[model samples]
Target chain A: CTSPCAAPFERRRPGFLTLGCRGVSTGARGDPHSEGKARRAGRIAVCGKACLAKEVFGETLNESRDPDRPPERYTSRYYLRFAFLEQAWDRLAEAGFHMVACHSGCAAALLGEPSDDRTWNSYIEYVFFRS
Target chain B: CTSPCAAPFERRRPGFLTLGCRGVSTGARGDPHSEGKARRAGRIAVCGKACLAKEVFGETLNESRDPDRPPERYTSRYYLRFAFLEQAWDRLAEAGFHMVACHSGCAAALLGEPSDDRTWNSYIEYVFFRS
Candidate 1:
């Protein structure tokens, strides 16, 4: 993941708002604790969309940023930050993982009219396989 | 999971709308394939709330149910069914899993006024540990 992707966690934002890709260690076929034997899988599952965050948060998202606070720890009650799909693709590509499958859609209840582009469609899930 | 909880998958709803609890098998500490060595973990992560689904889908949610379709397979374009938190608690308790921790809150952007209760808070995440 890139700097932007790690920014949320590095800053220790509230658990709910720190929407970022997480790596899950799936033990390899051999010894469980052997070094380099575990296959780490990165799942960007059901992450909030940047576009939707911007739409919903607007100016409050920017106002919450504080330069005085240490990067290692910070908290906010207002901002909701999430990465764009393009960023996820870029970071995974940088890490040499190829997209195995990707699915993007929103709930029927959140869908807007055919003529109306603004919708509440909020999340995207992606599965990437390491090459 | 109860009949209502299994109804969605039993009818083979569209992949996105099948917002039901799923059990993931985490290989047990010993043998990976041994009969009783695998522990199944049920995660009801980031599931849509029934209240929000009702608020959004309204009449369409009920209209999507069909009496003639076989229980094994069916699909719908209109329904966005999700279980209430109470239902999840009941199911997990019945399955012998105790609540390890649960945190429920909406995104700051989705939060309504202190006086306004009809907010767009859409989802809830729950974590349960098997005994």
Candidate 2:
């Protein structure tokens, strides 16, 4: 439809902006007409703590009709885009995560998967560096 | 004083948000107490083309007093953060650019320069792939 049917994202905080479909599936990934569960949690785990990164628009990940196996098998990725905090770059980098930005000002690099046909949300990878 | 004097940003387009001072200068880079040109244009060049990527709040880049040198020497970088366009991921990759994103979702990876101390703008590299 209209790329997740509407605004297709969440505005968590002042500078926090998540663009495109709610989860990875809603855009072209999860065609609304499909009859069953499309994908599972594109979750986030940092410092051994896991959190729900995807915004459930109409259906939550658990509300779907499939038994959960693992989030890794859920190939269709999701994105959570926001400005970084102090010490965030080094912290994320030290944990095997990568970042990019301009030279002098704040903000460097976008984060996520390598490359795919999907072209709405930003990229993300659930890499538990410390664990 | 309050990090670039105030709200420290410009809302160009409804989803297109530039979060931080007018240029890289107004922030911690160029404290208001300092009375001179701090940095030159941290501009943009894409597809062998360049455009006005910065917004001038009060003093335009040219309005400064210093004789201009190459923009590269003007470290204290600036940022422009927005969602990418269709075919952008592959196109960016083909241009020696790298991206990351979620697996099954539409959004994948961010783009820009490697890790640095700056924290407002998204990372960028003037890597001209074709040329």
Candidate 3:
């Protein structure tokens, strides 16, 4: 998975390269299997704008299962790994790549949420140039 | 200011264009002149890692001025205008551009803060392609 994933980036140099991935919560705590079971059992229901997650991933929130919990609280997908932007920048720097640009949190705006500083930091993109 | 600022973007087409700006706090409230005066008078002091703001902008926190307040609470620069990412996307789309990438919040990591979801959303960059 690592080599194939990195091949394209290594092959291109002295050229603009853009890379990005979905941001996952570093403090996410929950059991995906249990969440899936609960969702399948209809114990989970989509809440508020979090329905965007369901629309994109076919996943439902556990809000109905626990009414007292905040609506924003939800289980993250277990398979997705969180990416550390700082580490990525370090590695890229080591590879002689300089950052041309970086952006994050626009996904919230794309999903029709209010365009504000409070936008979910759920996606990140970086543009790098190597020479 | 508007025409000169937009000239470069309009001049380039069918090519990669990356644009970015420092992100400002949307809900920031306070007077910059007063904050500067307080800092110069030593009524304010740098608190924790927020000293990065000082290193970059010569600004200091009001922690000493109001020890009872949270250290994270501070006045923002009054001259900086907040940009709405959604509005930018809309305008870009209307101008016959399509987003190639977007990223935000990496400034926290660059300043040696813990790279996590809680990174400050203080910068945004977007790469667009027109064709």
TM-score leader? 3
Of candidates 3 and 1, the better by DockQ: 3
TM-score of 1: 0.22
**Of candidates 3 and 2, the better by lDDT:** 3
Tell me how far the alpha carbon of residue B119 in candidate 3 is from the true structure, in angstroms, after superposition: 19
Q: What is the DockQ of candidate 1?
A: 0.02
Q: How much of the true A–B contact set does each candidate keep?
A: 0.00, 0.07, 0.11
lDDT by residue (B8-95, candidate 3, tens digit) is 3445323333344443222112543332211001011111212222222232222333335332223222111224545545655665
Interface RMSDs of the predictions, in order, are: 19.7, 17.3, 15.3
Sorting all predicted structures by TM-score, with the top scorer first, yields: 3, 1, 2
Where's the lowest-lDDT run of ten residues in candidate 3 chain B?
Answer: B37-46
Per-residue CA lDDT of model 1 for A1-131, tens digit only, reads: 54433553343222222222322121112222211111112332322334223332344344244424332343332232332233333343343334444332223222333332222322334444432
Which residue pairs clash in candidate 1?
none
* Deviation (Å) of A60 in candidate 2: 25
**Model 1 per-residue lDDT at A74:** 34
Per-residue lDDT value at A55 in model 1: 30
lDDT string, candidate 2, A15-112, tens digits: 11111211122233345564433232233212111121222212222323223423212212232233223233344444333332222222112222
Identify the CAPRI category of the predicted complex in candidate 3: incorrect
Best by lDDT: 3
Deviating ranges (above 4 Å) for candidate 2: A1-86, A99-102, A105-131, B1-45, B49-91, B94-125, B128-131
Model 3 lDDT tens row, A1-131: 44322343445334444445543221111211111100000111122222222222232223334445332334332111212233333344454556666555433222232221222334555666656
